[model samples]
Target: MQKMKMIKRGAASVAIALLLLPMADTAHATIVKHYGVDWSKFQGNNGKWGYARDDFSISQIGGYYNGYFIDQSTYGTQVSNTIALNRRAHTYIYAQFSGRNQADQMLDYYLPKVQTPKGSIVMLDVESGNPDTDSVLYALKRVKDAGYTAVLYGYRSFLTSHLDLASIAKQYPLALAEYKDYKVTAEPDYNYFPSFDNVQLFQFTSTYVAGGLDGDVDFTGITENGYKGGNAQAPTTSTPATTTGKQLHQDTHNYTVKSGDTLSAIASRYGMTVNALVTLNGIKNANLIYPGQVLRVADSGQGSTVSQKATTTTTTSTYTIRYGDTLSGIASRYGTSISALASLNGISNPNWIYPGQLLKLSGGSSARTYTVRSGDTLSGIASRLGTSWTALKAKNGLANANLIYPGQTLYY
Candidate 1:
């Protein structure tokens, strides 16, 4: 985790005003929140999820996180991994899809193939090159009509520059991705929060290295079954009845350790004492905590269940600095912090960085099979794999290196 400086971008002023408007009261507590990841083709099975599993209470797996169908052969394998992760970790899992040609195809071609359970989210990943606003809206309508929770994922720039986010923000919850300089900033730029008034999730860092995953700040439990919007509707099965004064229990909520977070700070957030937290989670050394460590913040009654998710051992990778790179420039480019880089590389001074110095980029890469999908290119795969285009082509034995298709297995 890295501290992010919040700088207001152009449209933030108006969005703040919109946020000030009064609305119906909902349950407001630190418990109804979590942090998690959005996966894609580059990542493999849950074992390869690396340090990420330690930091997140929820995960949004993409057969649709990007707009492509996974290779059919491995598609079932991915779904099985998702379910196993959810059950073993007691984590909330949602399904996300990018919108373009695949938006309309989600309810048909994709959903059946993945078999995401009902009541789980089906989010729209809106980024550059997505379809027209009307087309995207219609596609969302189809998702909502299919009995899944519909949500929107886009950055402030993507929404402001590419589409009319205002039109749909009122209709659905917005997951905003807006990154600032994580090395120096302590928190996300509240000033630059998007103008779409219904912001639900804020992705503060794409390069969150604490858990070796993307960092997000979520207000609503989109993964925790707390985002179910009700209407003039019948009572659904197994829905827990709303109870006032339910005992504050560990199973009820959790908090991920963020950059600059201390045990005292987290205890303060949950209205608990430091000793209480330490006792609850069995912390032998309060000062030895690191980023991405999940802390149990609440106490449970006799029936309260405990999570079984354990942190797995992780590996590391190295990246040699290029001539033009500064510590800040490298940190920004790699989604890590200058401090983390310095700590990993054992540099005494953050300012002193040079070419040919190998900095640890992430946890070690695992050998895996990637099934190519529509719109994938060799160059794109190489960038994600941390290898060059020529290396990838040679590894896959491509004569042209320019052409590839869906369902082709390229080993890395």
Candidate 2:
């Protein structure tokens, strides 16, 4: 663990005000491109602390800094050297890991190593494919709670395919790592920007030899002048009105526990993790929800159960098929079974679904189409729409059932 001191440098200026402004209206200022390196590039640079790939000293490489792996356990092997190097370079520290509770622990361990000036970022490298969405969310929340300007870093596809970025995109400035269809001619050309609401930084490539390291561009204009400190106040997050002592009925809101519902199943349906559900609902025991228990399934604020504001508005009973839809996933979302959906739809095969297929909801309304969202599987879509993957594929004329893409539609 490293000891970090927060130092406010210079009189508070307009740049700091701009940095604190909400990102909903970030001006598309001509982004200044910068270059830097991560610990992976430092590996084997020098013998004992050969964790870096290249032996070039920090001052020699130049540009913005995002350094080291925080939760690799073996990261300590290079901590002494990394801290010493960062002290000379004043680089931002990144804490990379995949556990909700581990976020605080790792940040704690790395906090002592931060010798940089105050307001330095402690970005969370959120690339680990942890199925538990809440783990990352809670980890982000934990990072902010610790008074660090927590940023999220991962490739665009990985973020969309594996995690529900929609839940947290607005709150955290995305540090996207996307490498596709571009030659590294000089300053890298980033053709693919993430769909995240706030993109503060873009890491275009890990092979930018110009700086002999990974390449990044700062959109916030903070990194252009070098590392001036930024505060760690919590980012804005959406909070659903709470409902007390009643079952939730909003489409993506409250959920009623069914006979076969487990914490994992219910959490998945609402795009959350089991541990998150437990923490949100304050369940004394994770295995103790009853068949009729209504639980809160959204938001990082308030309790796990909806409060006095739970609504009774009925949602459309049918779901449209989107990319990444899967039979098991659909069933989990709707609190129904794949077999029931297959039987209802008269499908002989369960493994064939396509986009543009409509599916019936649990209430058995006319089949409706659902637009595919990132991280959606046919089964997951089926569960949410109260249909089966076979039914979805058959309705959409999909023979492979396993293939789907975003924006494609499906029927029940």
lDDT (tens digit, per residue) of candidate 1 on 1-412: 0111222456566434433433224433232335555554334433234344322323333343444544433222333343333321111122243444556655566444323445555666667554467766777677667666666777777677766877877677777777765543323455555534667767766566643445565555555432224210211211111111111222334444544455764554455556556645668987766655766665332112332221222234777765435665454333455677788788898878777887886557443445565577888877876778887654544445655544344555
Model 2, 296-318: lDDT tens digits are 66533212332222123333567
lDDT by candidate, in order shown: 0.50, 0.47
TM-score, each model? Answer: 0.42, 0.37
Candidate 1 Cα lDDT to native: 0.50
Superposed model 1: Cα runs more than 4 Å off: 1-24, 27-31, 47-102, 182-192, 210-212, 226-412
Off by over 4 Å in 2: 1-35, 41-99, 181-185, 210-212, 222-412
Superposition error at 119 for model 2 (Å): 1.1
Q: Alpha carbon lDDT of residue 411, candidate 1?
A: 50
Residue range with the least summed lDDT across 10 consecutive positions in model 1: 238-247
